[model samples]
Target: MNTPILLLQCLFLVLLSGPLFAQRWTTTSQESEQQPLRLHGSLLFQGIYPGFRVGVERPIRQTDFQRSNGRVNSHQRAVLFYVGMYYHPGFHLNTFAGAEYIFRRVGGRGLITEFRSSLALSRTFLGAETYRVGEAGIVETVLASGQFYAMPGLGFGMGKVLGKPGSNRPFAYMVNLNLTGLAPYNGLALPTPTLEIGFRYQLATTSVHFRHRIRTRQ
Candidate 1:
C-alpha cells in the first residue's frame, strides 16, 4: 500500500475513535455528554520549508486556582490530533499524522503556557525518480519511492486568549517550537526542529458553557 493511502486510513481511524477516546475521560453522566472540540490551524516552518497543520483538540480535564491576594488562574489537560505536510522543493515532500497530550496553564491576564508530547507516523516521498540495478544487471524504476518512520516529539508554546473580561472569548493563539525524533535512518536517530504559529477556535459547547471568573485583589 502507498503512504498516501495509509495516511488517509490513519486519519479516518483517528476521527472515528475520537468519541470513544473521550469516553474514558468522563467523570460523571453530565460530563458524558458530547463536549465542544477546538479546531486548530497553523503555519509551519522547518528550516525554511514551509508547511501547514490542522488539528482537532478536546479538553479532558481542567483545574482552577486562586492566589492569596485574590488573583485566579487555571490549568487544563487536553488531547490533540493532527496531520501536516511540507515540501523541501527538489529534495522531498514529507507528510505526518499524530496525536499529542497537552498540558496548558492560563494566567489571570489570559497568558498561556503549554507543553506537549506526541507520536506520529511519517512518510517522506522522493522528489526524483528512483532506479535500482537488479542482480541480473537490468535497471528498474522504483515505484512510489518513499520512506516511513515513527516520529516522537516534545514541544512548548506561549500565547494568549483574545478576550477575557466577559469570559466568553472562544479564540486563542499560540506559537510552538518542537523537537521531533525520527529513527531507523542508517541505524541512527535524527532530530528535526520545527516552529509553528497557530490559532485555536472553539466550536459550539454542550449544554453547560465553559467559563472562568477572575477575582480582583482585595
Candidate 2:
C-alpha cells in the first residue's frame, strides 16, 4: 500500500474518534479536574514468542451506577497508548505502537470487564539474510529488508481492581486476549492472536468522586 495514503487514513480515523467518544460524556456537571495518569506494564505473547510492553493510560470519563440488588457498579472509559516489540528470531522482528480506546465495566467484588478498539503502525525487520537476483544473473545481498504494516485490532478483557471499589487502590490489573490484523502482508491481511497480562499503577494521590447514574430493575 501507499505509505503516505495509509498514514493519512490512519490520522483521519484517529481524528474522527475523538468527537465520537466525547459524545458519550456530555454531562458537564459531572466532569472533574484532570484525572490521574496511570502507568501500564505487560508481558506480551504470541504462541510462545515473548515480548514486553510499557505504556501510559489517561482517564476520559467514568459513570457509577447502583444495581437492583443494591450493588454499586461503574463504567470507566480511557485511552491507552503503547509501544512494544517482539522477535521471532531468524524470521522477523516486529515493532509496533498504537492507541486503544477502552471501555470498562466494574462490577461486584471489583471484577471488571472491558472492550477495546485499537489502531497501530507496525514496522518489521528481516532477521535472515536476503538476496535479490539481477538481470545479469548476479545475486545481490539485500540489507535491511523489511516492510511496514497497518494494524487494527478488537479485543475483550477481564480482571480485578484489588481491594474495595472506591478505595483508591494504588494498582489494578487485567488479562486480555486480542485478535489483531496486519494489512498488506503479502497483499492481504494476516490475523494473529495475542495475549496480554498487564497492570496499571495509579500515580496521583488525589481522588475524585464520579457521578453515579442509577436505575432500579423491576
Candidate 3:
C-alpha cells in the first residue's frame, strides 16, 4: 500500500470513531469523582464486509459514577471515541469513526455487565467482481461502476468484562454481541448481528496511584 493510502486509512478511521470501545464494563463508587483514561482495542467480524476488522477506542471524559439499589455497589457511565479500519486489497477498503456510550453495573459474582451504543459514519470503496461466464468459461463479466457509497450507522450491544473482585485492572478480555443498522443503501438497511472480541486497559491510573501513595512516598 502507498503511504497516502495508509495515512488516509488511519485518518478516516480516526474521524469516524470520535474516540469511542473495545466496548467495556467498569464498576464505580460514588466517592470517586474522576475516573482514569482508558484504552480499548477490538477485532470485529460482521456480515456486511465479510472480514475481520480492528478498532482502537479511548475514553475522553472522566467516567460518571453513582451508587444504586441501596447496595455498596455503583453504576458507571463512559463516553469514548473510536477509529477503525478495513481493507481487502482488490475487494474493498473502509474507514470509520464513532462515539460510544457504556452504562455499566456489577453482575453476579463480580462480572461487569454493560449496555453499549454507538453512531458512526463510513466511506467505502468497492471493486467490481468479475464472474466466469457460461460453460467453457474463459470470458469474464464485470459489474460496471464499481460502487462508492457513504453510510451512517447506529448500533447497540450488550457486553461483559470478567474480573476478580477488588482488582483495579482485573479484566483483560471483553465479549460483546452487537446489532447494527446502516442506512441509505441497497434494500432496507436491516439490522445485522456481529460478535466482537476485544480488550481494555487503563492508560492513566490516577486512582491506583492514590492508593499506592505509601509505596510512592517510600
Whole-model lDDT, candidate 1? 0.78
TM-scores for all candidates? 0.75, 0.75, 0.54
In the range 15-104, model 3's lDDT, one tens digit per residue, is 767634211324332232334556777777664454343444333222322223322232455665776655556755555667777665
Candidate 3: 10-residue stretch with minimal lDDT: 209-218
Question: What is the lDDT for 27 in model 3?
Answer: 33
lDDT of 1 by residue, 1-218 (tens): 99999999999999999978645432321223334788889998887989988998877765555556554566777888999977888877889999989999877688889999999898989889999999999999998788998989999999888976212247999999998866666698777788999998878853323333333222
Question: lDDT of all the models against the reference?
Answer: 0.78, 0.78, 0.52
Better of 1 and 3 by lDDT: 1
Which candidate ranks first by lDDT, i.e. highest? 2
The true-versus-predicted C-alpha distance at residue 218 of model 3, in Å, is 39
Clashing pairs in model 1, backbone N/Cα/C closer than 3 A: none
Q: Please write out the lDDT profile of model 2 over residues 1-218, one tens digit for every residue.
A: 99999999999999999988655543323545555778889888866788777888777777765555667667788888999877778878888999999998888568889999999898888989999999999999998888899989998998888876642356889899988878988999988678989998887864443333433332
